[model samples]
Target: MSDIPQERRVLTAIPGPKSVELQARRTAAVAAGVGSTLPVFTARAGGGIIEDVDGNRLIDFGSGIAVTSVGASAEAVVRRASAQLADFTHTCFMVTPYEGYVEVCERLAELTPGDHAKKSALFNSGAEAVENAVKIARAYTKRTAVVVFDHGYHGRTNLTMALTAKNMPYKQGFGPFAPEVYRVPVAYGYRWPTGPENAGAEASAQAIDEITKQIGAENVAAIIIEPVLGEGGFIEPAKGFLPAIARFAKDNGIVFVADEIQSGFCRTGQWFACEDEGIVPDLITTAKGIAGGLPLSAVTGRAEIMDAAHSGGLGGTYGGNPVACAGALGAIETMRELDLNARARRIEEVMKGRLEEMRAKLPNGAVIGDVRGRGAMIAIELVKPGTKDPDAAATAALAKACHAEGLLVLTCGTYGNVLRFLPPLVIGEDLLNEGLDILERAFATL
Candidate 1:
């Protein structure tokens, strides 16, 4: 363990020998439908770096799309998972049940925001969590209509794709989507028709009014939103937006669901981004980093709403596998012991400071149109200067340059022009700075 190298050392060009050879094999053996962010295949990862199969180490800003918050290969996680593997691997929660599954639910009830009595159901991915939340909402309210916002991404499932607003990749050729799902304008400040200068309160009010007028609140079962829009350029709704939506949902008897699949578990400075405004959502969907790297997703909500579903109405064959439960237990313990929430804030401090400097220095030349997001879940929207048009070319160029220099980053957004950063909170300051420096240089060259 002590012999592991701490810094990145690029021995060969990114794809190198092994990765290139593997890529060719993968293209032949694997599905071409699958896409890759980086051509280099990973050999190992720890702290903030990923070593490719070619022996080239690169600084990782994308934590497996925010799945390794505690860092790739956390010591406690490894030990706990290994021990659990020796004890038992599977015994479906619904069929045989297990203590680890119950314990995970208990932890989720205790951790998720809200003092109300809560219950949880585990699943396999963020998409399943989302679908279950909708199912629970419909059962509880006995309503057919579900409300979502523009730019929101639920998942790739049939129902979630209907809820998701993007086309081409997520929704195109996949529809006709599930029925009774309605979409309203999101309070996206940058591209908002009213513009960024407008108060968030006004935009949210208008959105609420429009939705109520179109669908009539009485017909709605729930209103789902991401506290911080993930694939939507990390857009943080205007200040009063979330709180206003919460209030409206409460008054209309609509189930307020916060999709924290990407923003939960200290990814945002707080345990959940909804806590930023002291809003307690009726239902919360989570996954991604919930069980370290293991597959586990959950829907935790008010006890009554969760219980509305009849016995056996919810669950899956591998919903709460014992091994995943163990991993979740360890992941939660690691988070609490390490104070990762504070670490997220620390990451934000460093990131915001550097990004602001970048914004100032390259005001005109820099393609970064806007920088926003809370805690470690940060993103910079790229656009042509003096216009809101997306600068996809510039964004692509920057990402490629960074990868060539031994850095891993990701691009997202409805227009595919926003560069998102989801570095593991456990990443050392030196490594984090190195990745940032590479990004700065890439922007300068652009």
Candidate 2:
């Protein structure tokens, strides 16, 4: 559907002459804090390929960090957004409310898990949605403390940075974060101290005990978690772990918030990863793939809980902008028409199967500790061959190798030892296989 060709091509080196010039200009103009993975400078992107300024067509495995699940140039999204732009782009929802905003909230209430009465409020980013979710929970329960999991990644904002567990890149020098936030253990199957099999029961019990003894559940407003931790290595909390936590939250009258920002919108073969265990949360935050690359995030939850926020208490100047709402409506249409959920499942089958095979054939001293994740959000954790110690250097090397061959890949994890793959769901099967072939070759040389 896009004008650009879908195949990968390389006319020059990965960062060719033109990109070198742009990189210099970028270095001078852009702030030092902004970082990029493969910064060749994109000219155009569609389906599975990103044509760089150097005329090299790199296979896109990152999908702009899983924001373009429906393809960056999806037809429906473009048409709807263009129409909305022609009509009007501004006039904030609080000032002049639009039908688009109401429609988007309606759609969210219908799509999100659980048949109970639901309500939603839109925001400009995942962090805003998360912050609002916490606000609503605290206001409703009159509690102050919030609970997060180990290795969880919420956002870069002050409160979210406090929620996040990793220190190096995300936290480091940035501190003086919001208080009353507590971190507990997550059921990371591969790195569980006791063992993978005991991770579900033991970790859940430990987290619950800590919450009860340390924070006192009565004072906790919410317990938020990513059903599939994203930046934390695509770590899928061990089976039974999510349900157990959800149960505890319900029992203690605490709001269970599922931070589905990276794992929602069919990224994990379900509308939200919480659905995998049939664990419905009192509040769910979503973003990334919601609007076919347009910036839009939401906090959808029980009607009673959501209404707790005073009408004037929740909103942003740019929250649920009409054009973004139009893009979200079109994105929802595309998802239903294409059944992207099933597409994600098929991708999981093909990718996970290939990864398992590659792992089986690794050399005597190769390091690939675990292959995990579901649907389009797969990752491989790099370790020190026989031991479970993380090998961040190996992960960096593999990503660089793939980039050199014009295959855009990304690395993530608290320890920086995960190689994550998030190809667009609309990518052609041939392109998917070709990207995998490039990865396979990278692994072979490693």
Name the candidate that leads on lDDT.
2
* Leading candidate by TM-score: 2
- What TM-score does candidate 1 reach? 0.98
TM-score of each: 0.98, 0.99
State each model's CA lDDT, in order. 0.89, 0.93
List ranges where model 2 is wrong by over 4 Å. Answer: none
**Model 1 poorest 10 in a row by lDDT:** 1-10
lDDT value, residue 82 of candidate 2: 97
Looking at model 2, the pairs that clash are none
Candidate 1, 1-446: lDDT as tens digits: 11246587889988798999999999999987778999899888888888888889988899999999987788777877889899988878888988988999999999999899999999999999999999999999998899898889999999999999889688778778899999887788888776776747667887798778988999889999999999877889877889999999999999999999999999998889999988899999999888888999999999999999999999999998888888888888889999999999999999988988888897464567788899899999988887779998888999999999999999989899999999988888898889899989998788
What is the number of residue pairs that collide in model 2? 0
lDDT of 2 by residue, 1-446 (tens): 47888888888888889998999999999998999887799888888888888889989999999999998888999999999999999899999899999999999999999999999999999999999999999999999999999999999999999998999788999999999999999999998988889999999999999999999999999999999999999999999899999999999999999999999999999888999999989999999999988999999999999999997999999999899999999989999999999999999999998888888886833588899999999999999888989999989998999999889999999999999999999888888888889888888888
